[model samples]
Structure formats: C-alpha cells, structure tokens
Target: MMLRVFVTLKPSVLDPQGMTIQKTLAGLGYSQVEEVRQGKYFEIRWAGDLSAREERDKVETIVARVLSNPVIEGYRIEWPQEIPA
Candidate 1:
C-alpha cells in the first residue's frame, strides 16, 4: 500500500517558502496570485494486512503526535488503495 502525507502550516501561520513561490509566480506573470503557503509532503509505502481505515488513523495519529507541530502545522493523510486480504 502507498501512503501520502501532507504536512502544512496552519492558515493563520506564515509560510516563507510558499510566499517565495507565490512571488516568483507573480514575477513570471501570474498576477492573479493572491496567497501562498508551503509545507512538507511525505510518502510512505507499506504492504500489510491492515485495513485502510485503521492504517489511515494510525498515520494521522503519528502525524499529529510526532510528525507535525500542532502549534503551527496541520496534517492530512491519503491512501491510494484499500487494503486487501
């Protein structure tokens, strides 16, 4: 199974990296750019007999507790396919 994790800063927080991208795009003629926020994206792949819901919950928990800084960051998890026995 493949797991995709997105770790992002909270909306209230500022993302310098994302801001840089936004400015660059604007410089490139993307004048419509209004805002930009950047965060970390991680991918983990595991093959196991665990259910998708169970695995997803696990991943979320890990992100909330360990991977992400709740003070300024939020996290999301994605699975490409359901677990099969």
Candidate 2:
C-alpha cells in the first residue's frame, strides 16, 4: 500500500515564495492565475503486514512529528482507494 502526504502552510501564514511565484507568473503573462501556494509532497510505501488502520495511524504520527511544523504548517493524508487482497 502507498499513502501520500501533503504538507502546506496554514492559510493564515505568509508565503513569500508563493507570492514571488505568483508575481512571476503575472509577469510572464499568466495573469489568469489568482494564487499559488508552496508545499511539500511525500510518498510512503507500506510493506509491513499491519492492518489498514494501523498503517494510517503510523503514517499520521510520522507526519505530525517529523513531516510538518504544527505551528505554521498543516498536513493531510491521502489513503489509497483500494487495498490489494
């Protein structure tokens, strides 16, 4: 099984890098773009025999502790739609 994680700045936080990209896009004539936010993506593959619930719990812990800063960043987990039998 594989799970995907997305770590991003909270909406209330400032994103200078994202702002810069948006400005550049306007300069490049892509003015239709309204906003751009920067973030990190992680893919975790599970090979253990753990149950789906256990796997999610483990990944959630890792994400909260090591993947993102709880103060300024938020994270979401994307579980696979189907598990192989």
CA lDDT, every model vs. true structure: 0.80, 0.87
RMSD in order of candidates: 3.1, 2.6
Where does model 1 exceed 4 Å of error? 52-57, 83-85
Considering every candidate listed, which one attains the maximal TM-score?
A: 2
Question: Residue 33: error of model 1 in Å?
Answer: 1.9
Residue 85 error, candidate 1, Å? 17
Look at candidate 2 and tell me the lDDT of residue 69: 98
Highest lDDT, which number?
A: 2
In candidate 2, stretches whose alpha carbon ends up further than 4 angstroms from where it belongs are 83-85
lDDT of 2 by residue, 1-85 (tens): 7778899999999999999999999999999988999999999887764356776678778999999999999998887777432
